[model samples]
Target: MSRPALPELSLLMVDDAVKAALLEDFGRAGDITSQATIPTDAKATGVIAARQAGVLAGIDLALSAFRQVDPSLDVSVLAQDGDKLEPGTIVARIYGPARSLLTAERVALNFLSHLSGVASATNAFQRKITHTNATVVCTRKTTPGLRSFEKYAVRCGGGMNHRFGLDDAILIKDNHIAVAGGVIPAIKSARAFAGHLVRIEVEVDTLEQLKDALTAKPDVVMLDNMGPELLKQAVKINKGQAVLEASGNVTLSTIQAIAEAGVDIISTGWITHSAPVLDLGLDIEIG
Candidate 1:
């Protein structure tokens, strides 16, 4: 089945990211190599092609990078984010000043390749547990400045987002539990300050801790590093008291086992932090 459309990323967000990247690349000199080799009036056509098979993402951001560099450039997006791609697929085509195309090439490919990698990795994890009730999720362990973009790519690959940030939800981790003295205390502390609308989740490393956490009646409990057998036990103990989240040591090889254990959500940092970059190249022809 074809994947559903991904939500539109904010234009303002894309523009800001592209502008920052271009500034870092251009600095004061601004594309010295292109300026020296390409004439001011020189024109070129370029095709952004995938060098390997993977899911496509960040087409808009890539186009924005080019437009931000030169508004006069003609850009045609041949594929949208969330589309599955094969090697040699033309993701986008650009025709404009050779200098402008050259200037934007690296930055555009950086966004496209990195976000597509995130989508592809997410898709890999999602595909592993398609028959189960569990859903794949992304964590905050994203690139320092690219959390929003990375999380968006997760959704493009048919995964759900956990929380956008700390303010969106109260996730009481092991550190918080220790600081507050225990799971119940941590839940209580969060409940005291957080509004009633906020859902509280706590991470527990043991079934004993899970039992203790369940008594607090938090909205969700994360089973950290638990094996499938332990996860099944936790699910049985939960008995619909709270949502179960499986995290830690999650990989493409082990994800299916974790999902089969009956957890409602599985979150991993690898998709955003360590995913391999999708190989894409901008092949240009100067005229």
Candidate 2:
């Protein structure tokens, strides 16, 4: 199936993040090495190209990095986010003062490579389950202070996002179940306290717990660490009662089977928290 049009990430959010990253990297003194080496008026042109094949993301943040350093820098985005990329693909071309380009290089590639990695990982998961009536999803386990950016990357790679934070959705986890006394009560408490629009999801480790939690009518149920056989059983028990989300121990190797087990969503942590950064680099043109 074709992916939906990618959603707009707020320019304000992108600006704020780029500004903070620039501040952190530019701390105390600016790029002293660039300042000392490159002539003040010298200009350079370069193409930020992929060093390996992967999906694309975070081009805007990379542009923001360049502009934050030198607004006069001319950048042409040859490829947009969500595009499939290959080694030597020219993602963007830049002509700007040499010093500023060098100064902004790390931060630009940091955003591009990292978010592209997330997108690529999510894409791998998507490809695994393309035949099934299931969607790959990302969880709250994201880089601190960069959740929105990473979640946007998940979208770029055609994955659905789970709750952004605790406030948006009431997820009664195992701990919440323990502290609240039991599965049914925890969901009940959340139901009582939650607004009409709020969705309540509860995590259950056993079939018994899943059956019990369903009684309280949670909006969704996360079947933690269940194998495909158990998941099939759980799906049978669910029988369209509530949305079933299969989570934990998910990897590229295991995702397709999990999807085939009939869970509505497969929530994975590694895609965002641990996906390797795609390799991309700036090749300065000679002449």
Candidate lDDT scores, in order, read: 0.93, 0.94
The collision pairs in model 2 are: none
Q: How many backbone collisions does model 1 have? A: 0
Least accurate stretch of 10 residues (summed lDDT) in model 2? Answer: 1-10
Q: Please write out the lDDT profile of model 1 over residues 1-287, one tens digit for every residue.
A: 65666788999999999899999999999999998998999999999999999999888889989999999999998998998899999998999999999999999999999999999999999999999999999999999889999999999888989998989999999998888999999998888988989999999999999999988889999999999999999999999899999999999999999999999999999999999999999998544
Q: In each prediction, how many residue pairs overlap at the backbone (N, C-alpha, C within less than 3 A)?
A: 0, 0
lDDT of 2: 0.94
Per-residue alpha-carbon lDDT of candidate 2 for residues 56-113, written as tens digits (9 for 90 to 100) = 9999999999998999999999999999999999999999899999899999999999
Q: Model 2, which residues run further than 4 Å from truth?
A: none
Mark the 10 consecutive residues where model 1 has the least summed lDDT. Answer: 1-10
Alpha carbon lDDT of residue 160, candidate 1? 87
